[model samples]
Target: MDQEKVNEFLGRFVADLAATEAAGSVVIGQRLGLYRALAEGPATPEEFAERTGCHRRYLTEWLRGQAAGGYVAYEPKTGRFSLTEEQAYCLADPNGPNLPAAFLIALGMLRAEPRITEAFRTGEGFGWHEHHEDVFVGCDAFFRPGYAAELIPHWIPALDGVDEKLTAGGRVADLGCGLGSSSLLLAEAYPRVTVAGSDYHADSIALARKKAAEAGLSDRVSFEVATAQTFTGTGYDLVTMFDCLHDMGDPLAAARRVREALAPDGTWLLVEPNASDTVEENFNPVGRLYYSGSTFLCVPNALSQPGGYALGAQAGEAAMRELIAEAGFSRFRRAAETPFNVVYEVRL
Candidate 1:
């Protein structure tokens, strides 16, 4: 190999390594509320520590590392650190993109790297319930902001006539609901519709029930511990699966169940990761991130179940359309899309 080319590759490798190592620091910063404190105002490490009741030396090191990572701004003239508007939005604002929660999910799944590695050798499967608790919490936190921003205002309205039906006190079934974030959003937005949220994970279902009670929506919103294919519900005006269909071992079965659960004139809102029909078309940064998540999380969960099919996070629209059609759905159309997700309106 040419020495110059070797050095260039080494530079890229080191940058990637640095980013991987920084994931933990990002989680710690968020856990300790360092980013939020920094967003409040510029400060030296001592001042920040005083403001947040943290140790000064540790804060100093973290601040320096965060500055190196371009997550925060540093000033040599005054020896102070602060967050830029973009950084604060992503790292500090509770209603922002919640970038740290992504790191939390990554670290949580990586904690089971040994088990995942063994599963690779033995062809055994790793279920989502077997992963760290952070995986559950982080998954909810990471996706909630986007759902809050888009689900009510855009995704629901994108479905033809579904919003009006919901407004008129219709019923909804949210499969693979996970912590009920999407279900809660639906109930909150429409106020008249009742939502039934289901997940296979008992813990998730329990927490979802608790959240519904806390939101004072327990009267209309309910949760059950059930898989997508086994959820007990029928005659739903709208059925929804949010960023979850690909994780099922038998998504085709789930699709059929959704078809059965829907009312004659109902709509099925299926949301999935945005991907291309061609694999090569997904070689960019977003695809890279999704592929990594699929490898450790989505694929393993699907493998752990009964069916052998593991339609990964980047399974693409053509594959989804075929699966939905095979389940006896006559109409399928792209309803809406964000950079990270694609929404499909499916009808019987």
Candidate 2:
């Protein structure tokens, strides 16, 4: 290889390794409220310790690392660290993107590296319930913000006649509704509709029910422990799968189930990670992130179940359209899109 090209590849490798090291530090900062404290104002390590009651030496190291990673702004002259407005939005504001929490999901999956490696060798499957609790919690935390921002005002309205149907006292089934975040958002938005959310993981369903109770929406939103293919429901005016269809081993079966569950004029709202049909076309930063998640989480979950189709996170719209058509759905249209998700409206 050319020496310059080798050196460039080495630089990229080093940057990636550094990012991997920083992932744990990001999780720690989130757990200890370090970013939020720093967002309050610029502070020396000792001042940070005083505000958060954390040890000074550890705070100093974390702050320095964060500053070096461009996650925080460092002031050498002032001997303090702070978050920029963008940093605060991504790291400190829980209602904003809360980008740091995404690392927790990565860390959680990494904890199962040995098991995943063996799966690679044996072609065995690792189920979702088998992963660390951080995976579940981190997933909810990471996706909730996007749902909060877009689900009501944008995604719902984008669906043809679904928003009006919901407003007029319709029924909804939210499949793969982890922790009920999307389900709760829908119930909170449309007072007339009742939402039935289901997930295969019992723990996630339990937590979802608890969250529904906490939101005082227990009456309007209900959760059940059931897989997408086996969920019990019928005559739903709207059926929603939020960033989850690709994870199912039998997504076609799940799609057929959704078709059966919906009313005659019902709409199925499918949300998946945005991607192109060609591999080279999805070689950008977002695709890189999703491909990693697919390898570590989504594909493994799919393989662990019956059918084991493994339609990864970047399976793209063409593949999804084919699956919908095979499931006996006659109409499929792209409804809306965000940087991270592609929403489809399906009908019979």
Backbone N/Cα/C clashes per model: 0, 0
Q: For residues 211-266, could you state the per-residue lDDT of candidate 1 as single tens digits? A: 99999999999999999999997999999999999998999999999999999999
In model 2, the Cα lDDT at residue 136 comes to 95
Over the full model, what C-alpha lDDT does candidate 1 score relative to the true structure?
Answer: 0.94
> How many clashing residue pairs are found in candidate 1?
0
Highest-lDDT candidate = 1
Q: What is the C-alpha local distance difference test score of candidate 2?
A: 0.93
In candidate 2, which residue ranges exceed 4 Å CA deviation? Answer: none
Off by over 4 Å in 1: none
The TM-score, computed over Cα atoms with residue i paired to residue i, of candidate 1 is 0.99
Per-residue accuracy of model 2 over 1-348 as CA lDDT, tens digit each: 699999999999999999999999999999988889889999999999999999999989999999889999999999999999999999999788888779999999999999999999998889999999999999999999998998898999998888898999999999999889999999999999999999999999999999999999999999999999998979999999998999999999999999999999999999999999999999999999999999889999999999859999999999999999999999999989989899899999
